[model samples]
Target: MRIIGGKNALDASSVHPEAYPVVEKILQATTSTLAELMGNNSKIHSLNAKDFVDEQFGLPTVNDIFKEFRKTGA
Candidate 1:
């Protein structure tokens, strides 16, 4: 679900709002946009979640972000 009045950025995934920054970091590291990444396990498999880990979002959260991107829908 998306936050009202927000950009509806998380509208299509199971990812938590707190993890958006992690997602952004992942997107920046990859060649694809969010649209291109979603549900594409081929792309997701190439990602190394450890590279995106931060103080707030650790390995588990980063892995979850990877899983969320592989989902076909919310």
Candidate 2:
């Protein structure tokens, strides 16, 4: 769920198209770093890294965009 009354919540600059590339790069680096530190534990590693990104940057799943589109089409 989204933060209530949260600012900086949008697709443009809040999480823009351009920034996706950078974010992916950072996520990759983060995963690699964690894997190196924690070793090959896929479940724990993925969850930990995902939690970090979600907490810090807020990762939007495919459903988020689809929901917005559905609402706007009305």
- Top candidate (lDDT): 1
Candidate 1 lDDT over residue span 42-70, tens digit each: 98999898899878889999888888777
lDDT of 1: 0.80
Q: Mind giving the per-residue lDDT tens digits that candidate 2 earns over 1-74?
A: 33434452334223344344434544465564322323233432344324434433544542232233223211
What RMSD value applies to candidate 1? 2.3
Worst 10 residues of 1 by lDDT: 2-11
lDDT of each: 0.80, 0.36
- Please give the TM-score that candidate 2 achieves against the real structure: 0.26
